[model samples]
Target: MEQLNLLFEGFQHALTPMNLLWVLLGAILGTAVGVLPGLGSSMAVALLLPITFSLDPTAAFIMFAGVYYGGLFGDSTSGILLNTPGNSSAIASTFEGHRMARNGLAAKALATAAMGAFIGGLLATTVVVFFAPTLVKLATAFGPAEYFALAVFAFLAISSVVSESIVKGLMSLGVGLALAMVGVDGPSGTVRYTLDIPQLFDGMSIVVITVGLLALGEVLHIASRIHRDPAAERVKPNGRPRLRKHDIKKAWPAWLRGTAFGLPFGIIPAGGSEVPTFLAYGTEKRLAKRRGDIEFGQIGSIRGVAAPEAAANATAGTAMGALLALGLPTSATAAIMLAAFQQYGMQPGPLLFERSGDMVWALLASLFIGLVILLILNMQFAVLWAKLLMVPRHYLYAGITVFSVLGVYAISSSTLDLWVLLGIALIGFVMRRYDLPLAPVLIAVILGPLAETELRRALTVSEGDVTTLVSSPTTIILYGILLAALLFSGAKHLHRRARQRTGDSEGDKELIDA
Candidate 1:
């Protein structure tokens, strides 16, 4: 009841005519960027961060939050129609969604994506309304030791577990940590890696680095591949995507299951929605009808598309809760939003609730509004978004590169920032080529300073007793969860390899017999 009152108060703040207009504008702009190849929520938010400097903090954050969710909802349209995933989270949707499009079911695919996103976002926001305060209360009790331990858990879980190769993942973390060190040492009040340059003294701005690396780096990478031939035909919807009775029957169960799979992981510090989406897809494939209407990979299982879409959006919502209440970002988009909060001179954590309650509530309210707007836009304009695939790749990537460089330079008219941008672009290109995950690097960069500060404070309080770090029950549980994740992931990989080898051996024997 009390939570409901708070939400009503939040709606009062966010439902104003001016705030609603910003919400609509953010959604439209975010969807436009999401439809464009190589442009994602992180880049979109980073590029727009400078523009928000002149706005009130609440309005700025509301707009930023709208962009974040709007981008997630819009990316699937590109993935389904063009086989070009606008963001990493949309990759799974491409698997089944593109297949459906090829079968002349583009309208169905778009409708499912839009409706699934709506369901996931609505439910997840409700969860946030009920649970955010409790999570903040729990986080408030965390001592420095507990906080340090939590940070360690985030670093390990995101980098090592999420990436295919632990070595490459660690390397990414190393690079981000190195970047974080470029600024002056907060503890010792001495410069460590600035090299005496004036801009180096202030260290690399998060805005400058993020825009340069993600936006500009992505543009450069895309430009390098512009000569390659584009695949997939531009799909146009044949008719309105009204769900048939059968389609609804098949999709609703998947939506519920996917939501169940995603909601739990949102609070955890896993890399992003990828894990849950994959798990949902896998589960649906196994439980699907065997002898029947359609197979897993055949005519396109509605469950395949619906499940992952719901999970992806649900993960996005839960992730927002965790970020606002706990100061943790589970994905790249969330990391960029964190940077936006910092730009507004607001830190997200327990204290944020006490100090900036109105802004927080308004942000949450805008999320609901954004969801409705996304659903309407996606269902009505999906065919139009699909037409974007026809744009020449060279021109698209070229424009991206130009805009990215301009956005970065606009943030800080510094030659040194351009140099830093070029350096990070090379690094990002290499990571992409090697198939190393970039989310972990961003996560590490965001959390590295916090970890360092908390560890030092814990040591100071405990007289250097490392055991004191796990004294709190929450910290101990978090560590245990981290350990379990490592073991479970390792065991699953080994088991999968063993099964593959066994199947291959049996096939070989049969071939020899034949």
Candidate 2:
């Protein structure tokens, strides 16, 4: 009853004209970013953060909430039409969504993605509203050792699960940790990787690194193969923007299942939507085989479009809740938001709800509003976003390159950051060429310092005893999960290799005999 009353109060404030306008602007800007390939919510939020310094905290967060939701809605648009995902989270959507587009069912695919995202996001937000205090209680119980363990779990899960080869994943993680070490050490004021450069003391800018890896890197990679790769066929949205009865029937269950896969990981330190989205895609494929009616893989399946889209959106919602209640950030976007909170002289945790009750409640209210607004916009304008493909490829990529350079320079007007951006862009291009996962790199950069500081704090508290790290039940359970993830991924990899070898040996025997 008390929570309900406070929620009502929050709605009163959130519905104000000024706050609503900010939300609308954010939604529009985020949608534009999502429609453009290589731009994501994380980069959008980071680039926009510096501009929001003068805005009220409530207004700033309200705008950001809308952007977050809108970006998810828009990501599926490009994924379906262009076969180009706006971010890693949308990769699963592109599998079947793009297939549907190629088959001239672009409208249906877009509608399924929009509806699935809406349902997942709305349900997850409901969970956050009712269960936030409960989550806060759980978060308050965590100690330094527990946080360190959670970070380790994230590092292992992302490294092992995201990439086809665990070795490549671990290598990507090493790169991130190496970059994270560039700045002045927190405990000792000594810079490790700066090479005595003044700009190195402040550390590599997150904006520079993200823009370099995602935006600039993509641009350069495409430029290298522009002539080799065939031109993409522009997929025009067709028919009414509504799913067929059969597709509707196939999608709801997948959406629910996907939400189930995504919600829990938001609370854990998992690397964000990519993990749950891929998991949802895999689960849907297996279930489709048993059902036999819904096809997957080579053919376009509405469930394929629905489930992963839902999972990704659901992860976004729960991720926000976890950030608010736990002071924990599981994804790059959440990490930037955490930095925003810190800039405002605020800390998110159990005390946040008590100390900044009005802001928290109002922010929650804005999420609900943002969901409704974005759903309407996506349902109506998905085709409009698809029209982005009308632009020439050369012009499109050129614009993206210019935008990346501008956003990085805007951060500090420093020429040195531009050089760093080019360097990281080269690294990103190489990694992409080698099929190395980029999410682990971003996760490592964000969590490395936190993990290091927590480990140090735990050791200090334990009087240098290593056993103290696992003394807590929470720490033990987290590590146990990490071990399970490693074994499961390892076994899966080995099974795949065994199948490949069997196929090769059999082929070799036949050729020799012939």
Candidate 3:
């Protein structure tokens, strides 16, 4: 009841016309920033942290929260339409989202992403408002062993994309793991794969790898095939990209399920929204088979776009909650926000609410308001965004490459990164040509280090005993879940092969009768 009262007071502050204007401005700017490749909410917030010091703490936090949610919306838009994920969290959406656009469902994909993000953020934020402390405690319960198990879970969960071909999928995962090993090892203070380069000591940035492998790689692959496929061109959105009632109805359940995946990961240091979004995508694919949905690989299922978007934003909500309530940063953006808190002479933890109760509640309330504003900010301009495909194919891809290279270089202003990007882009082209999956590569790059570090920590604490990994209840549960997922995948594969054989035999019988 007291929380509810404080929430109402929060609304009182957030609803003021001045504060509302700030939310609107932040939402608009955030969406614009997110449309750029490799720039996400972390960049958006970092850029704002310095300039917004003039505003009072409540108003400043309100705007920042608005920008955070708004970035998710814009990130999805570009990921779906252009196959350019603005952030790693947006990567899962591109798996099906860009395919949906290629099938001339850009409007539907856009609507699904927007609505799903809104539902996820709204429910997740509401939960945080009421149970921030409890959620924080649960997230903090995860130790090194639990986090290692969670990393293993993420590796297996990506089997959704792995279903195309086991050999090729594993190959993609191996490449990611190799790239992840390039940095210096933390425990032994030894460099493994830096190759005597100073810049490589810190490791390959996810931003550069993702932008290169997805956006620039797509450009090169298409260029290589443009001669054979003379009609290769950007997909044009079929109609005004407005949200439809049917799309919302089909997506609400996915939104809810994705929210469930996102909420827990938000409070845990398990590599941000990437795992939940991938897990949500995998679960929806499995459910689609049960429902006999055929839109998956050929024409992109709406569930694919919906579930990942929801998970991403839901994680965003809980990340903000955990940051304010427990001082734990679950994402790169949240870590930057933690730094911003320090810059503002604020410390976030158990005593945060007591010291800055008014600002805290107001920031939470503004997050709710920000969701609505972002939906409008993105949806109203849908037609204009769709028109981006009107440019010529060659010019369009060239522009994308230019923007991507520039954005990547801006990260650390390194020429080495540009060269590495070209190399990764070539590798990506090869993988695409050979029918290898890209999602597993991304999943490994994101979680490989976490898995390595956690496993080492757990084993060292147990004095090199291998059993230390599975001794905990959380580890037991995680491994149990992984086993179940593998069993289900094997059954599905066998069933598919049997169905093909049966069809082939029937065709042979018909040929004999003829």
Candidate 4:
């Protein structure tokens, strides 16, 4: 009941003219970013982090929340029309969505994607509103050991389980851990890795790392491959994205089911929405098959488009909750949001609600408004958004390159940052070239220091007792989950290898479905 009152107060702030305009602006910009290939919400937020330095934290967060939700729907547009999903989270959508477009249901696919995102985001945000505060209570019980355990769990889940190549993911994580340690040691007061450079004492700025990696790195990568990559061809959407009664009836159930699939994963740190999205898609396909009405691999099922889009947006909404309640980032975008909190001199955890309750509530409330704005922009005007592809790909990437340089330089007006930016951008290009996962790097960089600090703190408390790390029930349970995840991932890996050796091409489609 008290939460309801707080939410009502939140609506008061979200409904203000300036805040509403920011929400609208974020929605537009986010969808545009999502429609473009090789860009995602993480890059968008990182590029905008400098703007946060000047705006009120509440307003900045509210806009970021808008962009986060808006991008979920936007990525589906490319998948349905051009068959080039902007993010992995939208891969499942393309399985049926692009097929639907090819079958002359382009507008229908767009409508289904938008509607699914709306339902899933709505339910997920509501769940977070009521349930996340409960997590704050649980967070208060965490000691350094537990926090360290949780970070390790996150590291393993993202780097080892979620990525395609375990070696590549772990390598990316190792690089990030190394980057995180490149500065003066805090407690020891020993300068390390600075190379006598005064600017290196405070450590590499998170803003520079984020922008360089996500925005500028992507720009360079795209520029490098522009001549080699084939152009994307999209089915032109002819009609308004209006759903008939029959289509709605078929899709409504899937939206709810997908939301259910996605709600819990927001807190799991399982490397973004890809897992839940695939689960939702697989479940819908299996159920449709049982009914002898499978529409996949044929004309494309509306349920197929509906479920995965819903699950993706649902996961995104819940990820914000996890970010606020525990300072946990389940996806790259949430990882950047965690950094944004630090930029504002705020640490998100049990103390966050006590410290910034009003802002948190307002941010949550604005999500609903953002959802409405996104639905309107995406559903009726999806074809217009698709027109973004009309711009030459090279030109788009070139603009991004210029924008990233200016944004990074504006932060500190330092030549050293520009040098660092180019170096990191080159590293990012190599990481992408080798198909290494970027999320592990971001996760490691953000959590690596905390993990190190917590380990040392635990050691201090236990007088160098190594067993103290797993002494608590919380640590035990966390590590137990981590072990289970590793075993499961290993079993799957071996099974996949065995199947490949036997020339089982039947499983290839499932691999691509995710």
Per-candidate TM-scores read: 0.63, 0.76, 0.96, 0.62
Per-residue lDDT, model 3, residue 406, is 91
> In terms of TM-score, how similar is model 3 to the real structure?
0.96
* Tens-digit lDDT string for candidate 3 (1-514): 9999999999999999999998988888788888888787678777767767898878888888788887778788778877888889999888888888877777778878888898899989998999887897798689999999999888866844445555676788889899999889988889988889999999999998998899988998989988888765656676656656776677888888998999898999989999999999988877887798888766998889889999999999999899989898889989988997887899988899999999999998999999998887667676677667667788878889998899899899999999999988998999898888888889999999999999999999999998989998999999998888778777777888899999999999999999
User: Which candidate order results from sorting by TM-score in descending order?
Assistant: 3, 2, 1, 4
List the global CA lDDT of all models: 0.73, 0.79, 0.86, 0.77
The order of the candidates by lDDT, greatest first, is: 3, 2, 4, 1
Q: Where in model 2 is the C-alpha error above 4 Å?
A: 5-26, 29-117, 231-363
Identify the leading candidate in terms of TM-score. Answer: 3
What TM-score number comes out for model 4? 0.62
Report the lDDT tens digits of candidate 1 across residue range 1-514.
9778877888899898888888888888887777654455666676667877888988887787678877877677766765555665676676678668656677788888888888987888888889876644543576787767767876776665546566677888888788888877888788878878878877776545554555556556656664562442233444556678988898999988888877755766544776567567656654663335464566577778898889988988888898988888877888888888887788887788889998898899889988987788778886665444345555644565665566556556888887887888788777767777665666566667878888888888899998888888888898998898778657766876899999999999999999
> Candidate 4's residue-wise lDDT over 1-514, tens digit each?
9889999999998899999988988888888776654455665677666766778988888888778876766677855765546566776787688678756678888989999999999999998889886644554577889878877876777677436567887999998898888888876788888889988888886656755776567667767876676553223444657899999999999999999878877776644777677667766765775587747657899999999899998888888888888889888889988998998999987689889999988999999999999898887796665444345656655665665566557657889988998888899889879888676676677677778888899999999999999999989998998798688777767887887866766567667887
Q: Estimate the lDDT of model 3.
A: 0.86
Q: Ten residues in a row with the worst lDDT in model 2?
A: 230-239
> Among all windows of ten consecutive residues in candidate 3, which has the lowest summed lDDT?
159-168
Evaluated with lDDT, which candidate comes out highest?
3
